[model samples]
Target: MQTEYRYITESLAINDYGSGDRELVSVNDGPGELDELFQRVGFYSASHDFRELCGFIRRFPKIGPYNALLLHIQRPGCTFVATAKEWKTDFNRTVKPGARPLVILRPFGPVNFVFDLQDTDGPDPFPEDLLEPFKIHDRSREAECRYALDRLLNAVPADGIAFYPSDFSTAAAGYIETAGIGSWQKFRGHQLKVHYNHVVSRNLPPVEMFASVLHELGHLYCGHLGTVDKRAWPDRKHITDAGIKEFEAECVSWIVCSRMGIDSESEKYLADYLDQNSRIPDISLEVILKAAGMIETRIKKGIPVPKSMKIS
Candidate 1:
């Protein structure tokens, strides 16, 4: 059965993660209020995907539901403080200056975690250059990275998980060390690297970008990266190896995009690649469909292995 989880707080006080000027207030104002507020928030609003909230709930299973409380505030300053239980009795409590309290209430269920949004800052959901992936300086195979990304993330089927879209392509079209520190996609302590170039020409279409993120998420969903040999591929026998790589990524991207009713450029790009590989019978839609079915099952059951499903 689907796990039924909810944010049982009576109200939600949210601000611009850290901006001192807290402007909006979101509460469980019932259906009508939610609808009106959503109309103002638009589709890509921060709260649109309740997956994060679900993560929050799961992380802190100790917090009671109906009995829990929500604290919403306007100015949750740098020193904004929070906790699961009473600070004075159950735990320690100390409010220092320079901090603002946005919301202060007991959660409805057992307490697992309490986050002061100020501490755990995240990326701004909307950025001007978010679509940089579509633009590339090189027209070589690197140009296909975004298209490959789209197929990998959105085309795969996975439950309760998704990949975040990123425009930071690398100069190495095959593999390179990621710069900076503490990046999320790091594998083996290295930032998740791919065989793509950092070229920019145009932003990936919004639907395509979203689909790309989902498609990459599928790679993670199926644990394809963790288990599958980085170099060994099923279609290594084909003359069009690049075509084969794109096909795998695209097949996953198409599956996730189709399942969620998202706009996918899969049909367009896949058709182009397939045309070039007309001699390869294994690169057919029937093969794609077979792979997708296997991916879908892995995502649904939360199986974290490539062996979970056999693509027959």
Candidate 2:
């Protein structure tokens, strides 16, 4: 019976079979029989800090096996069980005899229970501080990011790009425009003029400005600003499409900014953009990755900008 139970459980786990009417039909035995089978199959013990377990479940709501295991072991009125060591370590409380043990399967170590959680309507078990590190603050590392972006900009050809602070509205953080007006053109071939919102750049943290600059740079380097006739360029209509342009540029920004530990809305922007478009054009992932890599490399090299070409 023990061997048969193990075989059945392992089969269920591997194939993810037995759905709807077939679910738990074969395991219609009493709780004592199921408990004995679980114990035999090495599922008799588990542990976790109450808060930590709650947080883990909350963070990964779709964890199927763990959720199923919890449902299997949890009782309606009885408080949960904890190992003596776990109770001592985390709760500094004693476990009564009537509490049942919750089993957890560890990948590497001995299976053990650290703590048991009882149903409660009280405050959250995990404190805010536990999750604080995961939050992204745009200004927290602005100086480092600014230095990196400045270095990247410095590596580009001096004649090909120019930056200026403008009195644009707050909505416009920064933008890039081609330098030439007509066939005569003001600057050299395909040179770009980047404009940063002066008030926002001065008043807000530099991280937002840095991200905006990188996004515009992404458009320039990723060929979004190039003529449709250019080699490897997307179709003219797709290139001119706002959704496609924003998606590609934001994807570039996300790749580079994430690599540099800078936070941006690029992921959200890309996700929303993609969600709205049913048929996305074949944008080259390799191109985006390569562009991001080149930009990162340039920034990391820390090339010095000439004083005459410096943008204030």
Top lDDT model: 2
Q: What's the residue-level lDDT of 218 in candidate 1? A: 32
Clashes of 1: 46
Residue 188, candidate 2: alpha-carbon lDDT: 29
lDDT of each: 0.32, 0.45
TM-score of 1: 0.28
In candidate 1, what are the lDDT values of residues 231-266, reduced to their tens digit?
111222232445444555565565544443344666
Top candidate by TM-score: 2
How many angstroms is residue 53 displaced in model 1 relative to the true structure, after the best TM-score fit? Answer: 39
User: Candidate 2 — which pairs collide?
Assistant: 45-103, 46-113, 47-113, 47-114, 47-115, 48-115
Q: Could you list the CA RMSD of all candidates, in the order they appear?
A: 18.9, 18.3
